[model samples]
Structure formats: C-alpha cells, structure tokens
Target: MADETPPVDEMLYEQLAQDALRGVIRSALERAALPAGIPGAHHFYVTFKTRAPGVSVPPDIMAKYPDEMTVVLQHQYWDLTVEATRFSVMLKFGGMPKVLSMPYTAVTRFYDPSVQFLLQFEAPATIEEIAVEIAAMPPAEVEPLGGDDAPKVVSLDQFRKK
Candidate 1:
C-alpha cells in the first residue's frame, strides 16, 4: 500500500503566514506612532529575542536578559518610532531610561492585555544560535536602574509544542 501522508511543503506556507502576521504588528506600531498614541486603554507587551540580529539595547539589559525580554508600552514611553522593518522606542527600566531598537523578525510575541490580543512568531534563530551571535558582538552602552518597578511579562513556553 502507498503512504497516505502529503508531500513536504515547498511553498513555505508557514513562513508566509508568519510574515503576514508580522505585518499586523507593524501596522499596530504605525498606528501607535501617531500623535494621539495608542487609543484609550490599549497597551502592548512586546517580547523579543535579546540577541537577535538588528536588536539594540543597553548592555545591562542584554546581560540581564540574555535570552529574551518583554517590554511594556504603556503610560511611560517615548519616541515610539516605527519603520518598515524595525521599531525604536525609549522605555524606562527600573528608574533608568533606555532605548531599544528591534526588527520585527526578532519578535517572538506581542500581546495587548487591555484588549486580550496576542500574537506569537516563529523565532528565526534558536537560543543557542542567539547566544553564539551575542558573544560575537561588542557590548552596548550600560545603564543601571535603581528602582524595583519591572514590566510584567507573559511567557509562551506553555503554548509551544513540545
């Protein structure tokens, strides 16, 4: 008897679907960049690979969260700029201010708690690969935060397939 399983996917449909979803993130950021900023009661928790390509953050932050980090865009954020492939913003960590620039490809998850919106992306590089890559890069500027306030983060480990 012949096997019933379908052939492998040559069209890369999964990748295409991920790309389309990333467009949604890009669009939301664009809207958030508007003068009015994100509409009433809507905020985001964006999680990304700390060492992914095109990601820039303070050395202390990268050192603290060598694998991944989640940032909240809420009451205290500045210079929220979105470009075609990446976005940059100023956010406070503890009491210190830092700027982060990240490409959409680096994002693993995006969630808006107020509206219960969530999106998860396929990481282009594995954690081991990211570690190796980060080792090769020069250290970024460091800033120390003195306060106890930390952004709330939601992990996707439970949602990932084992």
Candidate 2:
C-alpha cells in the first residue's frame, strides 16, 4: 500500500554503516580466532584515535601518536584477540610490546592491504564520546547488496516455494 522505507538520515545512517563496517573487522578477527592466529594472506592497517575510550597504550606510543595512529597487523603482532565488543592486540613501537584495547567506534579507518578494500568512518561528535559509543551501541546491521531491489535478471525461484 505504501513505500515506507524511511528516508535515510545521512548522519545516523553513517553511524550504522560504520558499525556494519566494523563487523567486517570482527568477522575477520573471528576467523583468525578459529586458527588461533592470523590467516590466509589477511592483514590489517587499523587506524584509531589514541585518545579514544577503552584505548590503552604505553606512554611512548601516546607521545608518538598524540592524536591518531595506524598499526599494521602483519608479520608482527601478538595476542591478537578479538571479541564481539572490542579487539585487543599487542604491538611494538620501538621493539617494545605495548597492549592496546580499542573499541570499534574508536576505529576511524580500516584497510586490508591484502584485498585492497577500505572503510572509513566519520569522526564522532566529540573525541570524548567515542569510547562511550563503542562500549554502548550494539553492532549495526549489515546491508545486503543489490540495494533495495534485485537486479533486472529474471530467473526462476531456486526455492520455488519448496
């Protein structure tokens, strides 16, 4: 009777999109968890706000990356534990291992050099709000491809109502 998909609020939708984007990271890490290590030519360049919430880094890392920092996840990284809410990893800045706890919301950008796909999220309203949102907001929905409607390919139903 009515086409009632509400108009997208770009801002809110962006948040949702970003949340979904992090799901990709989550899934990748989850898969890694299966084998108990990084797998299958997959690596990440994760850039996050050092000052973001739930983020813990050594003093030296903070001093070097006062604002934002990008860490590589290839050939070098340890204790790469990823959970539903947040992922923790041990990385070295100057041959010294440092632990970092980062919420997905704190992640401003994620790049996988293996596949060459990247996702970038807009800055949260305030640097102060990042940690809160990352800890609070549930993971956003993953949108299906082909948009709202399927492509023009006319095909028989695979299920055919069984």
Candidate that scores best on TM-score? 1
lDDT for each residue of candidate 1 in 1-162, tens digit (9 for 90 to 100): 977998878887877898899999999989888989998999999999987778998999999999899999877889999998999999988999899999999999999999899999876575567466567756654445654655444444433322
Q: How does each model score on lDDT? A: 0.85, 0.74
Tens-digit lDDT track of model 2 for 1-162: 978997767567655676788898898777765655677788888888888656777888889888799988877777878888799988777777889888887788889889898988764333455445456755645456767855444233331211
Error of 2 at 75 (Å): 1.7
Clashing pairs in 1: none
Q: Candidate 2, clashing residue pairs?
A: none
Q: On a 0 to 1 TM-score scale, where does candidate 1 land against the true structure?
A: 0.74
- How do the predictions measure up, each by TM-score? 0.74, 0.66
Error of 2 at 83 (Å): 1.8
Off by over 4 Å in 1: 1-5, 126-162
What are the RMSD figures for all models against the true structure? Answer: 14.7, 15.3
